[model samples]
Target: MAISFAQCFLAVDDHDKALAFYRDALGLEVRNDVEFEGMRWVAVGAPSQPDVEIVLEPPGAGPGASPADRRAMAELLAKGLLHGVNFWTDDCDADFERVRARGGEVLQEPVDQPYGVRDCAFRDPSGNMVRFVQPRGR
Candidate 1:
């Protein structure tokens, strides 16, 4: 049996604002934007990696989360405590410059990580940390 990663979700306060960063700044393609069950579902993916997708949805969107729970989730997202995904880039510096030029809030400049990959980070419009990493040799 084989398993592959499919989709991941990020809590977003506004769909359009998230799109501005993910689609415009990061250059990910907008794969889906539609309404489902009274909620908007938006998904974005790297054009080079069609198999993986990232979904941007509102906080506290889970069926079982109470209003208070949802509020807490939103607060966490606002505080930059949410766990956002990392992206692998061919050129970390180029990607960092591009994102920064587009007004992305820089969290860290590109630096060689002791762990092996060079990386940089930024805070998305909703304050989630989005990291771009390039393997040292690539």
Candidate 2:
């Protein structure tokens, strides 16, 4: 049997703002957008990778979460303490510039890493540190 990634979640305070960044800025296509129990989930994926999707969700979306739990999660997300996703790119510099030009919050310029990949970072509308990496010497 082979295992593969299906989806991963990222917390966002505003779905529309997240869409502007993920779809418009990064060029990912929206796979699905659904609302349930007064919460929303937006699934987006790179057009080249149809099987994988990133689910943008509100903080404390789980059914078991309490109001205080949601508040704590929102605080963590606001502080950029929540985890984010990294993407593989063919051209780190070009992708970096594209995201920046589209008004993404820049965290770092593209830089070659000692471990052999060039990468850059940006904060999403919700303050998650999204990174793009391209293998070195490609």
Candidate 3:
């Protein structure tokens, strides 16, 4: 049997704003957007990676979390303390320019890392750091 990544999540304060950045700016496609169990369930994925999806959810959305916990989580999110995921792109510089042109907050410009990848970073509207990386020589 082979194991593979299926889904990961990012805490989003507003679903629509997240979509505008992920879909409109980052060029991810919305795979699912529906309401379930009194909550909105939204998922987005890179078109090239159908099996990998990122779920956009509210802070402390787990069933066991209390109101205070949710508020704390929200505060952390607003403070840019929550970790977001990194994405691999075929063209890091092009993607970086696109995101920047669309008004994404630049955290870092593209640079070749010692690890042998060219990468850049931006902060989403909700303050989550989103990174794009490309292997050197392509």
Give lDDT tens digits, candidate 2, residues 44-120. 99999999999999999999999999999999999999979999998999999999999999999999999999999
lDDT of 2 at 137: 76
TM-score of each: 0.96, 0.98, 0.95
Give RMSD to native, each candidate.
1.0, 0.7, 1.1
Q: Per-residue lDDT tens digits of candidate 1, residues 3-121?
A: 99999998888899999999999999999998877767799999999999999998888899998998999899989898687999999999999999999999999999999999999
* Overall local distance difference test of candidate 3: 0.93
lDDT of 3 at 2: 96
RMSD of 1: 1.0
Candidates 1 and 2, the one with greater TM-score: 2
Candidate 1: misplaced stretches above 4 Å? none
Residue pairs with clashing backbones, model 3: none
lDDT scores of the candidates, listed in order: 0.92, 0.96, 0.93
Task: Kindly indicate the candidate among 2 and 3 with the higher TM-score.
Answer: 2
Best candidate, TM-score = 2
